[model samples]
Target: MKLSVIGSGYVGLVAGTCFAEAGNHVICMDVDEKKIADLKNGIIPIYEPGLEAMLKRNVDHGKLTFTTDMKHTVHNSDIIFIAVGTPPDEDGSADLTYVLAVAKAIGQYMTHPKIVIDKSTVPVGTAALVKAEIQTQTDIDVHVVSNPEFLKEGAAIDDFMYPDRVVIGTDSDEVGETMRQLYAPFVRTGNPIIVMDIVSAELTKYAANSMLATKISFMNEMANLCHRVGADIENVRRGIASDRRIGKAFIFAGVGYGGSCFPKDVKALIHTSSKYDYNMRILTAVEDVNQDQKTILIPRILEHFGGSVKGKTIALWGLSFKPKTDDMREAPARVLIKTLHELGATLKAHDPVALEEARRLGLDKMVTLCEDNYEAIRNSDALILVTEWLEYREPDFEYMKKNMNSFAIFDGRNIYNPEKVRSKGFTYYGIGRQ
Candidate 1:
């Protein structure tokens, strides 16, 4: 199959590369000439664990290609995937300008019938909107399918190659069959391929991400309550997770949920509900809880230092939204960095992959981005655990005690045993442990 993917962003790049790896000829089209040129020179912009290697292999094998020529890509491919970014608008609804633009371009340039798949995460009725946009350009037969991706940033390749289930949304069975064929190789392990109406599929993506965000916010709230009640949220989470009905995943209590998906999706869902004059009460609270949760450690730090973090050198352990990916989009660490900086304190941060992104986000000028964990903690007043990277799980307590002016640690992710750290002659603070 010849597939053309519009947008070489995170989702588009991964999807196009994986599709090409699965024996399909894939042409990824993007408007950014510089980005296409970089890809042509085999430069991968983002850091996913195994993506660079796989993309390079596919590109070398001639199965995957990148170009800025939209007309040629649309004219050559049988399946056109609209995987452009739907960034949030002012009202919190997904901005559909890029998706709709691709639709119009495809309509103007397409010479044959094509299956236009929405590989990007968009709001409900977006497929219909894309369909309408393309129809307004030309009356050519086009089947717009909603195919939302559920790949996590760190484990995108595995998720794409071995999805738990594949959801294909289209009004016509003929379109569904074609999608099924495209995904048949991936679902060879007998995982189900769900086919449904296009609108439902679009809503499914938002609903899935929002529900996961709800879980994270709920857990963070419980963790905060645990701090007041002199209980450990970890134990409580363990007790509840044993229940068969409430299987454990995304239940870890932490600062909050942050990324490209959860924060935006939750807001978009709430906005959509408001459009119908319906209030999403639970999700509204979830959003509120998350917004506060991101800065949950600020008050603790202030109280510990007697209402002033002025002249404090805080060592930050992580800069990414979460571990194993360099993405810092909506990262809680950013919120903490800005708040701490406003308090007249200094920040020295370390992450396995996000140092460059921190520089790009201009956080490097505001704080010191270190290459190693020990370097981040050296000479700092306290150690602040943000992302809970696995390397920070165990550390040389002696080095921390000797190098720091104060033996204090504020754990936003609750990554340590409070008693154990206290036993090391240090005062340890966590989200919900007493």
Candidate 2:
């Protein structure tokens, strides 16, 4: 298959690269000439693990390419993927300007019948909207398929290489079979290729994200309650996770969930329901819980400092939303840094890969960006483990004890053992652990 993935963003780049790796000729197209140039020059914009190397290999092999010429790319490909960003609007609905723009451009320039896939996470009925938009521009029959991506940021390569299931949304069996053939290489282990209605496939992406976000909020609420009742959330999490039904995944009592997908998708789902004269009450509370959960450690920090953070220097061990990627969209560390800065507390933060993104987000001025985890702790009053990166799991406690102005460790991800930290003669504050 010859495929052209529009947008050249995270999803587009990854999907295009992976498809090319699977023997398809792929051209990743973007309107930004600079970005296209940078990609062709092997300068990846995002810091996803294993992406740059794979992209370079595919491009070197003549399997993958990058382009800014939309008409040339669209007319040359049999399958065009609308993989643009669907950012959230002010009213919380998904902003579809980019997706619709790509759709219009594809329709205008397409000379033959093509299979168009909605690889971006858009709201339900977007495929219908895309079909209608394309039909207005061209009389050619275009098959619009709703095939949402299920790739995780840090582990996108593995996820794309071995997908658990492939969902293809198309009314026609021919379109479904064509999508299945494209995805056949990834699901060699007999994982299902679920074929569903277009609307159902679009809703699946939102429903999946919302359910995961619900679990995260529920666990955070449980952790908060555990703190009040003098119980350990780790033990509670273990107890519940042992059950066959409640198998552990996102049950870790973290600060909160944040990324490009969950925050935007949850709000968009709520907004979509409102348009249909319905209220997603559970998801509304989920959003509220997550918003509060991001700054849950602020009060604890104040209590530790005797009700003030003025003149205090706090160290943050992680800045990204999670490990192995440099994405800072709606990251919990931003909430902590903003709140602590407002209270006159100076911050030194470190992440293995997110410093560049933090700098891009103007967090460098708000906090001291350090070179390493230990450097971040130098002369700090308290150390907070924000992202739970693997390197922060086991550290030289003596070095940490020697460099800090105060002996306090706030384990945001509960990756520390309370007894061991207390034995080191340092104050340890873990989420819902006594």
Candidate 3:
């Protein structure tokens, strides 16, 4: 299949590369000439585990290519995927400007019948909007299908190569079969290719992400309650997670959920509900809980430091929202950094891959980026574990005790054992840990 993905961003890059690896000729198109040039030279913009290797291999094999030519993209491909970003508007609704713009361009440039897939996460009924926009450009026959991506940032390559299920939204049986054939290589393990209405398919992506965000918020709420009741959230998590119905995935108590998907999708879903004159009460609470959860450790840190963090030097072990990816969108560490800086706390932070990104985001102004994790803790009053990077799980407590101005560990992810840290002759504070 000759496929063209419009928008060489995270989803487009991964989807195009994976499709090329699966024996399809893929052309990843972006309006940015510099980004297209970078891709042609084997320069990847985002960091996903195993993506660089796969993309390079596909490019070497002549299965994949990058281009900035929109006319060539529309004319040369049988399937055109609109994988652009739908960033949230001020009102929390997904702004469909990019997706609609791509649709309009495809309509103007397309020479023949084309299957346009909505690969970006857009609001419900967006497929209809995309179809209408394309129709207004020309009289050419076009099949607009909704095929939202379910790829995680760190594990996108694996998720694309082996999806749990593929959802295709279209009214025509032929369009559904065509999509199924394209995704057949991935769902060979008997995972279903669910074909449904366009609106349902569009809503599926938001629903899935919102549910996961709800789980995270619920666990964070539980963790806060445990802290007040003098109970350990870890034990409570273990107790509940043992039940088959309450399986563990996003149930671990963390600072909060953040990324490109969860926070945006949750808010978009709530906004969509309001548009229908309905209020999503539970989802609204989920959003509120997550917002507050980001700053849950501020009070504890202030109280521990004699009600003031001014002039205190704090060490942050991680800067990214989570491990194995450099994405810091809505990261809880940002909240901590901002609040602590306002309190006049000097900050030193380190992440294996996110230092440059932090610097790019101007976080270097607020927090000092260290190349080494130990270097971050040196001479700091307290160490806070923000993101649960693999390296931060176990540390040389002896070195921390000797190098720090004072010995205190704030475990935000609860990755450290309270008894173990306290045993090292240092004060330890863990979220919901007794």
Candidate lDDT scores, in order, read 0.92, 0.93, 0.93
Off by over 4 Å in 3: none
Task: Please give, for residues 1-434, the per-residue lDDT of candidate 3 as tens digits.
Answer: 99999999889999999999999999999998999999999899888999999999999999999999999999889999999988889999999999999999999997899999999999988989998999989999999999999998888999999998999999999989999899999998999999999999999999999999988999999999999999999999999998989897889898888888899999999999999999999999999999998889899999999999989999998888889999998889899899999999999999999898899899999999999999999999999999999988889998888999998888999999888899998898888888
In model 1, the runs with Cα more than 4 Å from the true position are none
Residue-wise lDDT of candidate 1 within 1-434, one digit each (tens)?
99989999889999999999999999999999989999999889889988999999999999999999998998889999998988889988899999999999999997778899998998888888998899888888899999999999999999999999898889999889989999998999999899999889988998999889988988998998999989999999999998988778888998888889899989999998898899999999999999999999999999998999999999999999999889999999999999999889998999999999999999987799999999998889999999988899999998889888898999988889999999999999998988
**Local accuracy of candidate 2 as per-residue lDDT tens digits, 306-357:** 9999999999998999998888999999999999999999999999999988
Model 1 residue 36 lDDT?
95
How many pairs of residues in model 3 come into backbone collision? 0
